[model samples]
Target: MSKLDPKLAERLRSNADGLFCAVAQQRGTGEVLMVAWMDGEALYRTLTTRKATYYSRSRQSYWVKGETSGNTQYVHEVRLDCDGDTVLLIVDQKGVACHTGTRTCFDTDILLSDSVE
Candidate 1:
């Protein structure tokens, strides 16, 4: 049902729900913004439209980043991992990337780190 190119679709390795990981990072800063999931249709939309489109697992629907919030992610490039299980989206982010209004989703949590020594 996806309108994705057959060749590109064939390379993807999705999970049981037919979704793959999508990581968004700031284009020039190289800062990781957020992580999401995407189906073939979402990927197709992102590629064609240059917008960050993701499949929401809890909502059971698709969402385009910045569609609701004014915080937008204008995608500059997309790269699929060699294993095709994950994708990296380079983007120019406007405003905060986290739903919590932080610049990035990872900003709040710091699990563990080695001593600086």
Candidate 2:
């Protein structure tokens, strides 16, 4: 029982592994929070429940964000890329979005080594 329309689901482009890339961003600030993957069922659950649900590649299961960490993401809008292979989710994020306890996942910076020739 999917809440998504059959036509819309069929139109989406999935990777060979049957997963689509989903990027979550802050609704107002437009800050990118994190990137995750979603299958059709996961996408349907997110759209229907208004919660950020993702497919865990390692766990091999559907996980609702903030379910354990209290960092839930309430979806404000969902957008599909022009290629239909990527999804962007504008959401109201609660608490820290990263498991490392950072506000977002993109905190680390890679510095170029001065020793590089």
Candidate 3:
């Protein structure tokens, strides 16, 4: 069981401009469910409440997954990658992971990259 790094926590708190990527994975089959970002407040909320919360750059607020849609994610474990800038959450998801009510956010492919100037 790897404990969260105190130093890493310090960096995360200090860098309010930084948003660490938080990836949610299925606990049963180890499939990646979704990817989001976590700011300090969101991280604290997730650690304390065991509910997956994330920071939305566009919304400029903390978005609680499943708060409105009933697709909540109960965190089983949170792991920091070796780089300490990304996070992985092993969670028990209720239903869809996408805001549009899809099974996962990864379901749709973004074609923007191809249209880049």
Highest lDDT scorer: 1
Worst 10 residues of 1 by lDDT: 107-116
lDDT, candidate 2, 3-86, per-residue tens: 668998887899988899999999889889999999888999999999999999999999999999899999989999999999
lDDT of 3 by residue, 16-114 (tens): 567888999989988788998987678878988899999888888888889988999999998877766788999999988878777777768865566
Give the clash count for model 3: 0
lDDT of 1 by residue, 3-116 (tens): 999999999999999999999999889999999999999999999999999999999999999999988899999999999999999999999999998999999889898979
Off by over 4 Å in 2: 1-3, 111-117
- Between candidates 2 and 3, the one scoring higher on lDDT is 2
In model 3, the runs with Cα more than 4 Å from the true position are 1-8, 11-16, 110-117
Error of 1 at 112 (Å): 1.1
